[model samples]
Target: MVVILGGSLAAACAAPGSGNAQPTAAASSAPALSSAPTCGTEPVTMKGYFETGFPIAKALTDEFTKQHPNVTFDIREDQFAVITQNAPRVLADDPPDLMRLPQVSELVKNNLLKNLDEYAKVFGWDKWPPSQLQQMRMAPGGAVRGEGSLYAMGLNFSMTGVFYNKKLAAQIGMTTPPATLADLDAAMAKAKEAGLAPIAQFNGGATGGLAFPLQDLMASYGPAAPINDWIFQKPGATIDTPTNLQATQHLEKWIKAGYFWKDVNAVDYATMMSRFMKGDGLFMFNGDWESGNLDKQMPGDVGFFLMPPVQAGGKQAAMSAPLTFGVGANAKNADCAATFLDWVATDTQARTIGVQIGGSHPMGPADAPMPPIAPGTVTESTLAAGAKIAEDNGSMDFIANATGAIYAKSWTPNLQKLVGGEQTPEGLLKSVQADYVSQVKGG
Candidate 1:
């Protein structure tokens, strides 16, 4: 059973049932292969559009082409900011076999995406963690997520956490990672006094850098049900509360204490990450997806840890979302695309390559080997941290995923003001809540 929050909301629209029976490869009208085709000799080419996650996609397609010499792929990769708003416009004129979905509800409502439920059954994807599956299901009319028709699947999965600089941590008289939020606070203060930025973050364009940290911290303060409900757009859910207020105020306090980069407002994500890679800060609030870059640039210097609990050894949670992808309604080679999607979950090489090169967890067989980890490497620490989150079942959706407009309409702007000393934390929270009510709730 899926461990989704808001039982009523999940139950509002029923998911089509698939029992414990395996489905055949020729589950749809697609031609069945003779001699058990690992690849077919058909002359077909697939087009795709994506924002990030290209490494995993490229790896899969490259390997697949080796198996079938006639198959080819032409995928366009772009920065997420460029394609997010223009998804619909681009899809209308130039549809690909697969594309990254930025506005799921909008795309679903407009019939722009193909439902993956049939493919999900054919692939027996139900065998994966139901929680992961839940993230892809969307109710009719796109009013609810986590149930109904399947629309997307993640190429890779990631969880948000704190990335620390070992050299800087020790320079501040710290020998071990923080075991609690209090310890993290003290370590940041010490790092600041040591003339290094405590947290290298960017809130200038998208506030995810700060928002994720605040959400991770808030996870420790109360039951995750309420928070998850709000993120899932449960009708009565709200983020206006003591715990969230405290989380917001905590970020404001950090900004006031100069814990963030001095030019945080002016700095964008690329610049902030570059600064952190240069060891300009003690900790960077980010996701495990950055592990690949860190592994390449500062292999032995960086490490990862989820935000510790309010008290040591308490339950921990982190904002996690799949690096999701969807099929276009007008996809030319969807059958082959489905094969590629299923391969990620069934083929060991695809799964391993995704983890090793993409720096993310795999949804393959349960017994799949964890990627080899090197001592003092970001990959080692991040994989370990990701394991704990999975063990605890502490994954939650990104807060921005609550609605299509949440990030640009509220979060980035309000958070900019909060960090700029132009808006109070409470004011920022209120503004965000207003956006949720307006866009998600239609209030």
Candidate 2:
């Protein structure tokens, strides 16, 4: 999982037990309670390992236990980078019933993740839109994705865009969401001129938070297909392209103009969000995962919009992908875990939790009724932006998810260098492409 910054999906590799250890509530290994696994009316404690900083999973688990008193969750939480580094060993040695998964190709290759094909049949997930599950499929040996056996499921489909401080925007005379890249730049310039941080971004720690805005810039300058192809690991795919370079240069311009905080490279995701919420920044490049949080913390003060394209009326695009989780291949409660995954999508209460708590589009059949959102809340705006992205067919997976180690090893460092003036925009893309090529070749 490449950490998506605010709601990261970045992955890293480390020796077993090398990263900070999470507190395990249960013993490392739990015995299988039943040979024939089913979500039976028996006492069950589902062990889950979830990413920290997001309340949706915990909220959903609490609701699930409310509905199924016989079932309960014993969940552990950790940062996304720690989870990425520790995933392999955890899956191999003391697998949880369900866990937040990073990129699944490598895990599927190692058989660490359970194939959910049978669960799809039992839960009628096969009847859902094919595109809903497309990103979770992987070929044999995990050499390719977007096709093959299903290995994971999402709590909800999340999308990324620009989240703004409405009060600050009004101060800068930004009455409406920017309609183009030039418009967006002008808004940022106004914010900066007003002595406000234009973009409160997180580029520090183990995730390259700048990747969020950079990727959005990529979509604005060109089509999302090439970016998706690169992330999906199509043969001969490359990230160092002309359009992307133009995008990179634009981001460099933002940095040069002091749109971001001077110490942005030192601020972690939590700090960035905290500052943004406190009105320290006028804009934030983030995902819908923060919509619910913002709605609660700031109420109607925040607004969201898809990253506008280079020109007004140009097709819009966004980094839209699933908030993926998977059952461990050797889980002691596979049946209950699969049941939980299915419930997240189809159960009315669970789907509502996904929308109101997860701040993402619920993954289910196309006709599934959406939970109502307050007309002017950030969640409503984000969901509306998601609809526009869907209508334009401009969804893309995060660039950090191109490979398991690429986020931590390549993008984060190169992007950090770009921020520090140690790497030029062209050099940043070239260096990342080199690392990507090596990783693709299993270096």
Candidate 3:
């Protein structure tokens, strides 16, 4: 996302969209000081199903149990695909207290999630910025997201961008990361000449790893609102636009230039990451969530940067989303689950642990400081990129989140076709847009 460093970081450390002033005025000033709602000392055991595994939730629970010593958790972690696929059965048979809800609109439509409006009120969550509150809302019958009553909240904020191997960049005679799309092309050409994979990619399993960058490039050409409107399935929104076509053409151009790994389609996520860590590639187009792993495996050698703007100094935009979750309507410990969910925002210990362990931006109130990331580290760099996105309000939801089945049904397979020589950029976009039309129209 595009952030002028000073303004973005300032916004990150204060209220988003608010002009300079007190960083700790709203909810951050007042801790979790609402009524002492009780979940009893009966050893409240909550079963949590998550798309994200142990680290984030575990950290929160570790701190949460300190306040409510009677609470215990039985958390079941799974890959996003598995949890999303099983959501129906899980909800039908016996639902966990906290369930990662990817198809939040669908569940809300089915009335399977506990409406969080009451909890939002009790926690004083209305005090947060309007933009954040909007993301959590959905209209009655779940026909629309980004408005109405709250259904879910993200555990941690996330950002996506390019992760570059600084050492590799320097070896190619690059003094700094690219400042524009043209600069990126030059760097890629240089990396190619140096026998480096300019873009470390894996399209064999999921196209999101590749497609999201393209989407970000498209976003850079226009305002963030249209992209967000399309993703949120806003009325009259269309993805078959000129700028997105340019983005798709650009992806094809990179493919033809041999910028991506030749065997990218055969590689998997783990292998792609392993290769990037081993310095086999100059750049990896992905997200900040991977910062924790890169920090562990490739310390000091890596850095993160947003895709340069289309022009030398234009605004940048990228897809971002909260690591979202919901309470099950049938959950036994629903009250306890709501309490835990509320703590993610109101509790300082939870916020600190979220940043430190998850490399996540905060989902807390305006006055909350950006995570105390250290200087000159990749984590700090990524957080800076994220801070800018927040500051500029440049982030839009991931396009894949547009619909429950869009990734498997549309994004990945169509992108694979585009890169595999079976589809034109225009053809591929039409194909994906067709699916969106069908989904929205119930055709």
Candidate 4:
């Protein structure tokens, strides 16, 4: 995903391009909003914020520089929060040649993003189906609308699921993993009976420790149903609804039952990750991005599965969204940055980099006749099985960054309140609904 600090989209439903056919906007003759080519001209300087740390940008810069020897990649790294605060300021002073944004909603709400609707067509976004606008928190048109343009070319997609220790499961005499909420309950109960910590969560980190779990809850209904009506749109959904109520009470039951480690709340990202990798907790909820680190974290084998739906045969919502890249709205050598972004978005080399490094690209390294993972790592089958679980569920649009934080902030406090026995699900729902209604609608 690409965003120029400025330049812009609106009005009229441009038909969703037929099939995965890439669309070309009518930008051949028009001046590029934020940049132009840098192959032979002034040095193109581009800046970006990387998610998995500086190594990602370092890797991409190395690869990108190899092609455009004249282009200089000026990349920075920060926690997603720092980047969020920095974006508007950067746009206010000078937007970099590029920025890697985590959520689709940022480009939308801040108006710092530049639209790529034209770039999509020129770059064949349809051919790169995963490169389309990230739909995490926004509605269909929200990305282009909020950012004043379609400012990102998304890459590196992942789905939501749970990871667990197979060794731990076997120790409890459970052969099959959980396939439903009941199964999960049984697993939790057994883990408790066997004197295991049972489950793990890095709630103190992000997603209020509920990002993937919330997606799991929503998955039971179908990909779009929960997000479109309940979580995303908030269509005045009531806690009184059986499904909502079930979702509300279900996880809390485990928490109260001593299914979770007591220290989970005290452990943030670093500590939690260390424990997950080193400890004997039975289950973890996270994306595959954690797999490599997890391989190192666990003294025993680490694997994953999709938590089953509450309702049998219910649709599973696969959480996949764009780790969107964008053109800086205020790029100095705008053309060069645009070219670099285009190269990253379209070139096979750039795509392959992501594939190799466990970054987001169409193919996973393990997808082939099977690429080699590190030694002492989990089997490709284990990872693929988890991926297939997410795939089977239908990829739900990821919850965009902006709304994501809202949920994390709101959801966690409310969930803590409910689980700690300070509030009921209905009260929690009303509290959250009021907050969303007030903040989202400015009502």
- How accurate locally, in lDDT, is each candidate? 0.77, 0.87, 0.78, 0.56
Off by over 4 Å in 4: 1-42, 51-54, 102-110, 130-149, 205-207, 221-223, 228-241, 311-314, 333-335, 345-348, 359-393, 397-405
Task: Determine which window of 10 residues in candidate 2 has minimal summed lDDT.
Answer: 23-32
List model 3 lDDT by residue over 170-273, tens digit each.
99988888898888889999999988889997888764467766787787766788877887778888888998898888889998899888887777788888
Per-model TM values vs. the true structure: 0.87, 0.88, 0.88, 0.78
Please, what are the lDDT tens digits per residue for candidate 1 over residues 100-149?
77857777766667777767766777677777766777787677776787
In terms of lDDT, the poorest run of 10 residues in model 4 is: 20-29
Question: Taking the tens digit of each residue's C-alpha lDDT, what string does model 2 give over 130-241?
Answer: 7678789887667878877788999999989999999999998989999989999999998888899999999998888999999999999999988988998888999999
Question: How close is each model in CA RMSD to the real structure?
Answer: 10.2, 8.7, 13.7, 9.3
**Top candidate, metric lDDT:** 2
- Kindly report which residue stretches of model 1 are placed more than 4 angstroms away from their true locations once superposed: 1-40, 206-208, 441-443
Clashes of each: 0, 11, 0, 35
Candidate 3 vs candidate 4: the lDDT winner is 3
